[model samples]
Target: MTSVPDERFPLPEGFGPGSVWADRTGHRTLVGRTQRGVEIPIGHGEGEVNPGELLKLALIGCAGMSSDVNLSRRLGDDFAMRLWAHGTSDEADNRYLSIAEEVQLPLEGLTEKEIATVVKVFGRAVAAGCTVERSVVPGIEVTHRVLGAETDAPEEQA
Candidate 1:
């Protein structure tokens, strides 16, 4: 992947709440950890969530959680639902061009009108409350600076 600096991107003030970091544990592998002791396996290996999957989940997962209140008001509190997110990658840019989500739920016993209302409510709730979705829609600045680099290292510094 290649990167180009965009000065228009905002420079964030400080780290957000909580501590999150990753450690190299193997070849092309990393173990991401949270301040609360949650460990997420991140790598290209055939295991758990990698970086790309994590990004997609952040989008769909936020939608599901935010829409839960509206969906539960229409469907029962215990209604079953499944959400999946996929991204269309732009190979030339090495980034996702777009993302689409498919939500499956038990809509049996409800009228056609009621079903439509439920779907509309779900969408509206997500649009209003899903932070990740809102951020991606308008785009957000993501800046990276490699830590532990020496001034006299092999590569040039920014």
Candidate 2:
């Protein structure tokens, strides 16, 4: 177990989002609320969004969104983009061996040199500020703990 903090860190209230998971029928589903309080169903079934899939999604989503913002600023809002992320995990050892992301952009009007420049700028911006990409590139330290009793409370009482 990780050591308990002796003093609370100074942080803004509700700094991070929250999620709720429940068993729906036989499938496990995860739901989260947006900042506007709109519920979003993330995934269902064991295989739908297992840990590895979630990891890949976080990487791709973060990079895609960040790059989209940068690209829109540079190329205006008329361009289209597609991003894909892939990774190989050694489940037996519980580690990821490699992870890669590919981005496709429709640069219909730009010259080869301009396209290259845009790619370079996007790469630099993503490396600097994409939260998920930065977290995974060097990896992050995860700490967990068990709370409450082993058995869940009744739904009516919960």
Candidate 3:
């Protein structure tokens, strides 16, 4: 249960992000820890999920969170819903090309107009509010550095 970054990917501090601690648990598997103490399993079918799947989850998770308020206002304060994200990997590019999100919302008793309004509101809310989606849409830059490995501070500075 270890994804020991071989000589191939050398960073010593896990992937490029400063937010996750991807400690190898086994071959191709790592447990990503966040500052909040949440642990996310990561791997290529090794852990709970892979990186690409995580990205899709991020997108849909953001979408649902963003639409929460709007949905509650119209669909009742206790509306129920489930979200899903799907994408296929592009082996040549080593990334997912496009991801699609689906939501199973309980629009049971609402009229056609109400359902339409709810859908529109949810769509607009997600488009304007999901920061994760926004960031992924244009792509963001990720710069990383190996901390504590830079250089020893002088005794006085330390």
Candidate 4:
């Protein structure tokens, strides 16, 4: 497992900003080391999944998990959750065309007002807590570096 970048979660308490370990092949499992150095396994489905899609899935999954825990704790009942997100972008300039997420949260037992409140709260929390979602906000500084097999940092610096 490779650690996600700082742009993701602020490196949980025990995990470092970017610390992860993963099995080389078969049964994909990526263990992230929190800042506190606790090894937490990241769950994944058993199938041929694209690494690119997994990046987006991470954010969605985290938000879904967070909402589930929070709502369950507050309401004291397990609620059904359905989350779907899709985004389009231009490959050349990496410009986003559109990004949309639909969260279907069932509050069958709760009152209407309570349902509204839950949606608002959950939306805010996911907006702030979801790393991929957060990254879409403008003005975030990011740098990309390319390193070649024969590149020498010291020489390049000169």
Candidate 5:
């Protein structure tokens, strides 16, 4: 498969490394730390968000963040926006096939021209500039490395 090209973009400062670790509770709990030392707990149990859910959230969050910037510029600071994202996956293979996002705006007092402008700008922003959505659609490269050696082995019985 052909690899995607690397392109650099300017990002705001304060972005740094984040990490996640399996918790010791033995209940598939994970703890995450942000670059600025904020702790986030992720659990895979009742009333918790699992890894798959987090992936979907990342897409929606990026879409909202990126689109909102452009939308706000066009629709003014008083406009309100909401978004919903849904994904379909093949259960047997655990593969996602598609994702759809709906954008909603409260356009009660807006003119027809204003509504049209808002829709056009928001759609363009989400389609072209949503970083997470763009990245996932084209796929990203991943590399893995091992840092430790095995310490024990049991003898085989014939």
Candidate 6:
């Protein structure tokens, strides 16, 4: 099968908070200026996928894309895909500590064994390649500390 043209995909040159550019087709491009800015693409989905929700979707997309790319190389263009992702995050601070997602692979013609293998391979691809998935995984340790004493007093003491 014919492969995706190298020209179709290229890495971005300069990217940081507030960086901006437009493609040859004139599509607008904006670089995140901050953590909040980092997720600007999420707004495109509006109510369906809020800005924060898009962040979750972005993770899924990243993983899904990685899997699809690998699968395509092996299975070619005949395979079709439909991906849906949903998860929760802390809007108060924009911290994401937990997430759950489902990936469906339908092989109308392939055998059950093929489907099982696809799931296994896809899971590995998602786990290994998805930035968000890797971030959520348990191996990474996080530590938080307060530089000074807590400022807020108990409501009863106040």
Question: Which residue ranges in model 6 land beyond 4 Å of their true spot?
Answer: 1-49, 73-75, 89-97, 139-158
What's the lDDT of the predicted structure labeled candidate 5?
0.55
Model 6 lDDT tens row, 1-158:
22221255563565444443322322333222232322233233333234456555666677668788766754567666656554556678566555555554545565656655565566667656777555645532111111111222211100
Q: Give the CA lDDT, 0 to 100, for residue 139 in model 6.
A: 34
Model 1 C-alpha lDDT per residue in residues 10-62, reported as the tens digit of each score: 43455355546677778888888665667789997778677879988887788
Q: Model 1: runs farther than 4 Å from truth?
A: 1-16, 140-158
Cand. 1 TM to true fold: 0.74
Each prediction's TM-score versus the true structure: 0.74, 0.61, 0.72, 0.50, 0.64, 0.51
For residue 70, give model 5's deviation from the true position in Å.
Answer: 1.9
Number of the top candidate by TM-score?
A: 1
Question: Model 6, residue 154: displacement in angstroms?
Answer: 42
Q: What local distance difference test score does each model get?
A: 0.66, 0.56, 0.66, 0.50, 0.55, 0.48
Query: What is the per-residue lDDT of model 2 for residues 1-158, given as tens digits with 9 covering 90 to 100?
Result: 22221234443454554422223333456554344444445464543455667777777677677667778876788877676666667789788866666666766777767766666666766766678767766663221111121222211100
Write down the lDDT that model 2 would get.
0.56
Write one digit per residue (lDDT tens) for candidate 5, span 95-123.
77666555566656767677666665665
- In TM-score terms, candidate 4 sits at 0.50
Q: What residue runs in model 4 are displaced by over 4 Å at the alpha carbon?
A: 1-18, 21-46, 139-158
- Worst 10 contiguous positions by lDDT, candidate 5: 142-151
Q: Looking at candidate 2, what is the lDDT of residue 147? A: 15
Q: Rank the candidates by lDDT, best first.
A: 3, 1, 2, 5, 4, 6
Rank the models by TM-score, top first: 1, 3, 5, 2, 6, 4
Q: Which scores greater on lDDT, model 2 or model 4?
A: 2
**Of models 1 and 5, which has the larger lDDT?**
1
